[model samples]
Target: MAASGRRTGRPTLEEVAARAGVGRGTVSRVINGSPRVSEQARTAVQRAVAELGYVPNRAARALAGSRTDAVALVIPETEARLFTEPYFLDIVRGVSGELAEADKQLLLTLIRDDKERQRFEQYLAAQRVDGVLLVSVHRDDPLPDRVRMLGLPAVLNGRRSEAEPVAFVDSDNVGAGRSAVAHLAGRGRRRIATVTGP
Candidate 1:
């Protein structure tokens, strides 16, 4: 793995496949969880990978599967509130447990303003993350568009619209809202009111 040409500019799996005398699919299957490969093919692929000093890009691998080996959770919240937000904490815990079952890493980023978000976009564009899970997206945020434009696989947490169309994981916000109102009614809190806004 310690080669001169591998100076941060990693070779593609195609290079490994070429060296191994296998198709890209075979290489991919080997990288993934496929056990259908022959012993000879497996040895060849492994040797070629070792010889070429190839590294698979996580972002590319993320696209091939529904879940990635690494996911960046973008929090567009104040650092103060990020710690206090109980729901965010619960979501993070669940995400951590689920990802640990698959042996993945979690990257956390907190962006509170435009300047920081712009800088964060550059980091995201560098392909350091396999997938992104953006949280607390506001209506006028530019970052969602930035993530979408990069063609990276992304899943927004708590916010998405069909018109914009993004993969996301969210609690039943509307249902919870209704439940809150019902609870208030059950308590006999007459002249009740609720405020809803983005």
Candidate 2:
């Protein structure tokens, strides 16, 4: 405890409770915006919080509620590729915009090798994120299954196969190709050759 009779570190929930002349649970309820708290108690907690300059500890609150309020967007690619490739950049922009609207933090991770993949698995095991968004997955990548096994919600940008068990979002390559060809044919281009990916 400090000489002021409060804890030595940052002002804790108990200190706020003491200042507000309310129980610890009442302080918590008021801080969490619980509707059950009476107007008078809420006003007291707010006043105490402002007077003491108390800021809620996010890490402690996450541990208590089992919610980090953060989402990890894992892209297994090199930094060069992530920056150079317009597709990856577009994905990042779209995901960031949506996550911002939803009030969630986005953790962008790039796994370039087996070693990094293993390290990411360990990080997931620690339950540090609320959910995961996996992009640019390979056919044999094991991360999708590993994320599922950890019991965390996950969504893949694309699927490995038609029978992919994980939830995914993918573009219509065939439809896009057909549309492109039709556009060229409409412009009276006879010889239409398409280049496909490896």
Candidate 3:
């Protein structure tokens, strides 16, 4: 088929191959900038690509170069917790937006209990994702330590404690709470109680 005929969506490699009068491997080599392909084949493939207005899939290209271009967003919460709390949803939204800009995919995994946690650890060991983002990990959770030992690029939403080894992002809960209490006191609400969360 002609290059213009397949312009409705992203043009595939086969269309480029047919247009270039070469095989799929030759087109792949040309796209990957391999020197093994002949100059004639490369030029033909390039012209075909230009004519087709072909844009290479970043994820496929990354995989061709031995990279996944995927990040795992690990949430250590039960199904009930995930639905009841808006925090996880907020994190997923922000992460998804940012990752889309970067042309990466997010693999969300919720490790509710020890069994799931162990299974996830095994999956990580297989190098499924390029990096990890851990959310709501408590001190007792072994995920942080296990992820660290795997030498994966991992970031936590909050630190397990004051001396967390891995990278983490923490909100100023203390400052926010203090400001709230002061505001309440100013309104003559003396019987205020501060409730902490897990």
Candidate 4:
């Protein structure tokens, strides 16, 4: 208890229920956005929450619901490469934005070696996150297949090959190059020289 006669720590669900003049379950239903809650109860609970400045304990909620509401974005690259490459930075930014909109947490993971990859697989087996998003996959990388075997939801930022079996989002480099060349040729340019990296 505090000097003011209130609890010193964060407000509890029971306290909110008492303040709202409803049962504990009603408060929970209102907080969880359940349709079963009546408008009057919902309004009362919302008012109580606002007045108490209540914030839900995510870990407790996850334990109760069996959902972490989190997504792990696995990038198999060195910290130097991850920070230095604009392509990687762009992917992080885009994923962060989308995850924010969905009200889900993003766990950005950098796996640089086999040990770290093994650790991540262990974490996956623990069911720590709801889903995964993989980026910067190599042609022969087995992590994608491992994730599939675990029956976890995953999306790859880019495909390892044209016949990639996993769900992936990739740009059509060949089609893009063809379109660029056609556009350039239509403008009366014949000497087409391009630069690419290995």
Q: Which 10 consecutive residues of model 1 have the lowest summed lDDT? A: 1-10
Write one digit per residue (lDDT tens) for candidate 1, span 1-198.
Answer: 357644355777878898899999999888775899988888899898888777777766777664456778888898788889897888788877887897789888899888999888998787767778887887677787789888888888756565667777778878998899899989998777778765
Query: Using alpha carbons, what is the TM-score of model 4?
Result: 0.91
Per-prediction TM-score: 0.60, 0.77, 0.69, 0.91
Q: lDDT tens digits, residues 1-198, model 2? A: 768865677888998999999999999988777899999999999999999889998788888889897899999999999999999999999999999998778899999999999999999999989999999999999999999999999999989999999999989988998999999999999999977689
lDDT of 1: 0.80
- Candidate 4: residue pairs that collide: none
Cα-based lDDT for every prediction: 0.80, 0.92, 0.89, 0.93
Measured with C-alpha atoms, the lDDT of residue 170 in candidate 3 is 89
What ranges in model 2 sit over 4 Å off? 1-9, 97-103, 172-195
TM-score: model 1 vs. ground truth: 0.60
Candidate 4, 1-198: lDDT as tens digits: 588897888999999999999999998888788999889999999999999989888888899899999999999999999999999999899999999999899999999889999999999999999999999999989999889888899999899888888899888889999999999999999999999999
Best by TM-score: 4
Query: Which pairs of residues have clashing backbones in candidate 1?
Result: none
> What's the distance in Å from true for residue 75, model 2?
0.8
Clashes of 1: 0
